[model samples]
Target: MSGFNNRNHAVLLPERLARFGPVEPGAKVKVRIPTEHRSLPFDQAIWPEEAAVLRTVSRHLPNVPKVLATRRGFSVQTFAEGTELAAIWGSKPNVKGGVVEGLASLFAALARIPVDELPKPPAGWPAFGDSTGFIHCLIDYTRTRVEAPAHARYGPLFGALGFPADALRRFSDGLPRDGLTPRPFVLLHADLHPRNLIYNEEDGSLHAIDWELAMVGDPVHDLAIHLCRTEYPNRGERQRFISAWHRAVRAANLPAVADYRRDLPWYVGYQRVRSVYTDVIRSVELLGPAPTGEELDARAAAVCRVLARAWAPVGLPGSPSLGGVRAALRDWAAERSEPGPPLADLRARLRRRLAEARTAFSGYFAGAPAPLPPDGPPASASRMRAR
Candidate 1:
């Protein structure tokens, strides 16, 4: 499935749609298909969804991609050439050099967005400045979408690993009894790690290419997730980015944002729990018909690390040791090498949702806004005449 770069498959269409307006036929165009997996429970979006996000954010940020066209299951975005950010940074993500500042600047730019400029956030979007509510919403989402949906298949694994069936709920219970101080919500490029970024060395610009996971939430939460997603090599590197973010967010003057430093750890703790589930589930998926000792050891080691971060926050029964974690993982694998329920039903539901998304897009925004009309000849016609 190719749409918003969360494992989507994008192809260069052979011909531009007539609606794409006049451009040289050779001008690039792309079509995206939302893979069946994209419809799975792990997938979701909030109010002011992707199209509206790109349309508005692109107006203020030049680097964001434009939504050129859309239909039921997928959309087309204006394509550009640049090196993928992952290719530059590779596996160990130092995210150093001017690139570090560039990343911080992107976060700052999002912080400056005037809420008045955006359409009303959906009914449940935590009122502006309700930072506590924002965190609650996230926890709720994990409980409902991430944990609950897959519980039937993964519940035993979670239990075997010492997590209570009510782990998320317990974690939720642990939030400060005194509500967090308010900080205005702002645009969050929730998935802005390297893969979703593209760098153009000729211009020294890093452009955000995916908006599907974009959200409006506490600014600190955004930074926390980014750091967690990227996993800083050392505490110094983490603080360095935080300093950069502080400067950028300060310059943006996003009220109460100055206080982000105090709350970063809590959000990071929250991220730890999220990582616990996602990483554990992924490890199970990696198991083979006959799991090799090395493979199991690697997976167990990874889970051990994440669990060490998450256990206290989640308030599991006892301290989790590496040996204990490895044993639990081995046991879970023995019982069910594969995690997750059957997919045929999920696929059917996904297909229906994609159809619904297409219909809704047509009604609300006329099937996504068409790109600028060709000022002169249609690209195809120009090619035909040349031939």
Candidate 2:
């Protein structure tokens, strides 16, 4: 597919494969497979092995896709039948009228769902009304899952850019795990953003897809993620969304937001910090072992933007300029190569396989051919699609 917005590899199976799709009405259908790009340990997932969380949550949320099935390890769900929300609200997002009201109502409905009715939560989930403990869970997951795993390869790069080895630890230490206002834990879409939302102008309704990162946590945590992920046209529009969110939460009788004003910034801060590390590492992976001038520049520009925003949030000693970030990424990549080799010889071998390695990860279905080809060879995903 030309557009792949999710962390998972998703495909719209052709009509012949309709027997493998869910038994819903004759609508568009797609299947999802977890991406092999082992980049980060998810802070948003509580049960890593549970593939049915979306299906379970869908059972309760009617607007959510209900007839989910699995085939050859791919989770099949009906395509959201509407215009992509991001397309409706272009780069300059509006905050007034039905857009604001509809988004607010969606959040309110999500909050109102009784936690018991949803899927069984993971062990060691925060006790009832434990906002502080809830945040700690996320911070710890970032440290243990995201940071620790990436340390061997990316630790030095982080240090080079002024991120302390103990950044996550410090953030965790400063956080109070119990005394903060007790916000009741509730279902969080965990990855909600305009791209994940589908808007139907006919009925003025919004539907959300991709609940792979969904979790049960403090409600404000949900708001913090939405605020960070969705691009607002301006500050006033952002505040409007927040105001609408509070109004809707109160109307839903879910008092999981009492101290959101005080707590929102840090949760927002945490997300920014997480993005810096994740973005840089992702750049390195995308560069592969042999990045061309254009590839390096493109990745550098993106990383530099995220790195610049992260200085204050992660307590970096100094702000990162674009030039410095490009240099750091360059040095980091060079340092990763082995001590002895004809660099040209090694790269020649790697370059031949790099194209297949990248696309196949995102497109390979069990026993299915590879994904879209790069024109060098007929990739298995592309071949399967053609057949």
Candidate 3:
């Protein structure tokens, strides 16, 4: 057929969903649909690439799913039956080590994908797997365009976060200019947040969905992003997941996350800035004049918390003398010299950092937060940082 509706796409079938086994019931297939008109940047070529990624994944995971057919702009692939990990993450049973184990195995599979063999990201995408060099480009673009027009609204808020537009641009443009070169690349799912993770209760397995942004780059970025998500159940669960992940990576003979830990602060800071700009715009549209007072305060605080935690990690150093985010990074490395604190202690520290970040972001607590664009560059790069 020339065209098919989203519902009719064979990939949305119930039986196809069963193949995933342990997943919950009624899970929907999340394939990209082609756009008829120019809408968001994401609509441009996402489906084509998404389709390719799905097929590639199918090749590697032979038992995963199958595409019954394809339409001009749409294709049918097997659905995954399951509950989103985000839904019952804090609940009992699921909270134990089961979910962690499932995810660990799933991530191990993703980490092994050969990056050089995958489809390339859209044009102008910086290599180094999204966050590192790609983020620098995004901030540079934002500084040149978004920040100026929206200055009056965001100037104060940006100042409070210690991320004025000029400063961001300077940091981006001045990044070890040579850092732009691409190194060994690995296929990255980019987005592995709770919503995208499906846990099959029946078989006690996990399936990672959403591959629209897959690309090749450093594996540590992927682990860092996953680690950040696992950080949700407070720090205790986060540590267990990290320990599990460390063991898995080591056992699998995969690259470790130590390098990512070193550079994570910069990527985190980059995302924080991007979030402020994006959220500002979203708040403005969702609520006229943009969220202000307590709402604004809360939102700003959340953003700042992320910034503050990442600040020390990126600015301080391993040894004396080096300063800025780089120096902070060294300090963070030095702190891990111990055998690693108890999970509870790490959770407390993480919560404290989050609280501090919120305070820093909410300096404009009495007024409207900055107003910027609701969306930025394709999340492919930033999302990669998340992975």
Q: Best by lDDT, which number? A: 1
Backbone clash count, each prediction separately: 8, 6, 25
- For each of the candidates, the C-alpha root-mean-square deviation to the true structure, in angstroms, is 9.4, 6.7, 16.0
Per-residue accuracy of model 3 over 221-271 as CA lDDT, tens digit each: 566556554446576767687677667755654443545445655555555
Q: How do the residues 237-304 of candidate 2 rate in per-residue lDDT, one tens digit apiece?
A: 89988999999987885576687898888788778777766666656754555557776787778887
* Residue 38 alpha-carbon offset, candidate 2, angstroms: 3.2
Model 1 bad stretches (over 4 Å): 1-25, 38-40, 90-95, 316-318, 337-387
**What are the TM-scores, per candidate, against the unseen true structure?**
0.80, 0.78, 0.59
* Candidate 1 structure quality by residue, lDDT tens digits, 276-323: 767776567546545778877887888888887888888775677777
lDDT of 1: 0.67
State each model's CA lDDT, in order: 0.67, 0.64, 0.48
Indicate whether candidate 1 or candidate 3 has the larger lDDT: 1
Distance from true position, residue 301, model 3, in Å? 4.6
Clashing pairs in 2: 369-380, 369-381, 370-380, 370-381, 371-381, 371-382
Worst 10 residues of 2 by lDDT: 378-387
